[model samples]
Each structure stands twice: as structure tokens, then as C-alpha cells.
Target: MKALLSSRPVLWFLFLFNLVVAAVAPFAVDGTQGLVTAAGMGAVSLGAGAGLLRGHGQGA
Candidate 1:
């Protein structure tokens, strides 16, 4: 588990993929529902995922 967490490629992939989904998902829908989901996903990826990525890079 620690080994996997330390893997840069895997961490980067997870980070970028979630970010992409957050960016593109809003456009995939046409109503307030889409906007709400996008906001939630964006917060998770840009907020939480960013913290993970930063901690990983800093070896925290």
C-alpha cells in the first residue's frame, strides 16, 4: 500500500484523470444537475486530490 502510494506515475494518473473528468463532465449535461455534479467532482479532484498530489511530491 505504501509502495503504491509512492509511485509517481500512478499518483499522477489518478490526479489528472479526476481533473479531466471534473472539467469535462459539466459540458456532458445540460441542466442544473450536471452543474451540481461537476461542482462536487471539481471540489473532490481539485481540492482533495491536489492535497494528495502535493503531499506525495513533498514526501509527506
Candidate 2:
């Protein structure tokens, strides 16, 4: 779990995925759909960050 979380490629993939989602979100939909898109992206970003932070603490 720690190794996976600390992996650079995994982190980059998540970052890129979030970027793509965020970039497409505004133009791909509207109203509730837009809100949902934003929320989903936010959740992914938050989860990745939280996991990395937790893993970093454990590693030290």
C-alpha cells in the first residue's frame, strides 16, 4: 500500500486523469451534470492527496 501510494507513475496518472476531467467538465455538460462532474473530480483529487499524505507520514 505504501509503495503503491509512493509510486511516481501512479501519482502522475491520477494527476493527469484529474486534469482531463477538470478540463472537459465545463464544456461537456451543464447545470446538475456540471456540478456532478466537478464533485467527482474534486473527490478524486482529494482522495489521491489524502492517500499520499497518509502514506508519507507512515513512511517516516
Candidate 3:
């Protein structure tokens, strides 16, 4: 588990894939619900994932 998480290539793949999820999230549901889902859930997860990927690079 840690091995894959610490791998640069795997991290990059996950980061990019998360962006796809964020893009589609805005249309996964109806009306304001979908927008909320995208901004709240999707964006939060994206921020955390980005931090994880970048943290490793900056030696955090």
C-alpha cells in the first residue's frame, strides 16, 4: 500500500485521474445538487490528493 502511494508515477496517474472525476462530478446529478457535489466533495478530494502528490516532491 505505502509502496504504491509513494511511487511518483502512480501518484501522477492518480492526480490526473482525480481531475477527470472532478470534471464529471458537476453533471453526475441534477440541478444545484450536482454543483454542490462538484465543489464540495470533488474539490476537497482533489485538494487533498494534490497535497499528497506535491508533499512528496517538496520533501514534506
lDDT of 2 by residue, 1-60 (tens): 977866756765776688678668868888888778877886787677666666675534
Q: Model 1, range 27-58, lDDT digits (tens) per residue?
A: 89878877887777777666546656567646
Off by over 4 Å in 3: 31-60
Q: Each prediction's Cα lDDT score? A: 0.70, 0.72, 0.67
Q: Provide the RMSD of all predictions against the true structure, rounded to 1 decimal.
A: 3.3, 3.4, 3.8
Clashes of each: 0, 0, 0
Which candidate number maximizes lDDT? 2
Query: What TM-score would each prediction reach against the true structure?
Result: 0.57, 0.59, 0.52
- For model 2, how many clashes? 0
* Candidate 3 overall lDDT versus native: 0.67
Residue range 11-39, candidate 3, lDDT tens digits: 66666676676678777887887777667
lDDT of 2 at 56: 70
Instruction: Give the worst 10-residue stretch by lDDT in candidate 1.
Output: 51-60
Candidate 1: regions farther than 4 A off: 1-10, 56-60
Order of candidate numbers by lDDT, starting with the best = 2, 1, 3
